[model samples]
Target: YADALRVAQEAAEALPIEKDAIVGANFLLGLAQIEAHTGQSKEVVKTLRQLLTIPAGEYVSLTRLKIDPVWDPIRNDPGFQKLLSEPEPETVYR
Candidate 1:
C-alpha cells in the first residue's frame, strides 16, 4: 500500500502540468484513491483537494466518486463526505 502510494505520487508529480494536465490530474486522483484505500483520510482529502484545482478536474463525475469502491475507506470521513455533498458545477452551452 505504501509503495503504491509512493509510485502514484511520483508519477503524478513527474507528469508535466502544462502538457499533461488532464493525465496528471487523473494520476493525482489515483493517488488519492490509494491514500483512501490505505486509511490515510487526511492525505486523501488533501490530495483530492489539490486535484480539484486542475481544469481537467472538473470532468470528474460526482456520481462516480460516490459509488467507486476505492473510496470506501474514507466513505464516512466528514471531509470526504462534504466533498461528495457539494453540487456539481452547472455547464452552460451557447
Candidate 2:
C-alpha cells in the first residue's frame, strides 16, 4: 500500500499541468483511493478536497464515489460523509 501510494503521488506530481487536467485528476483520485484503503482518512480527505479544486474534478462521478469499495475505509469519516452528501452541481448545457 505504501509503495502504491508513493507511486501514485509521484505520478500525480510528475504529470505536467499543461498536458491534461483529467489525467492529473485521475492520478489524484487514485492516490486518494489508496489513502482511503490504507486508513489514511486525513490524507484521503485532503487529496479528495484538492481534487475538487481541479478543473477536471467536475467530471468525477459522484455515483462512483458513493459506491466504490475502495472508499469504504473513509466511508464513516465526517469529511468524507459530508463530501458524499453534497449535491452535485447542475450542468448547464447551452
Best by lDDT: 1
Instruction: Name the weakest run of 10 consecutive residues (lDDT summed) in model 2.
Output: 52-61
Q: Candidate 2 residues 9-93, lDDT tens each?
A: 8987888444666687788788888888888888888777666555643445567778877788889998889887887545332
After superposition, which runs of candidate 2 have C-alpha atoms over 4 Å from their true positions? 16-18, 53-59, 89-94
- CA lDDT, candidate 2, residue 6: 91
Q: What is the Cα-based lDDT of residue 62 in candidate 1? A: 64
Candidate 2 residue-wise lDDT at 30: 81
Per-residue accuracy of model 1 over 9-81 as CA lDDT, tens digit each: 8988798455586687788788888899988888887876665555643545567678877788899999889
Q: Estimate each model's TM-score.
A: 0.75, 0.73
**Where is model 1 more than 4 Å wrong at Cα?**
53-59, 89-94
- How large is the C-alpha RMSD of every model relative to the true structure? 3.8, 3.8
Name the candidate that leads on TM-score.
1
Candidate lDDT values, in order = 0.75, 0.74
Q: Count the backbone clashes (under 3 Å) in each candidate.
A: 0, 0
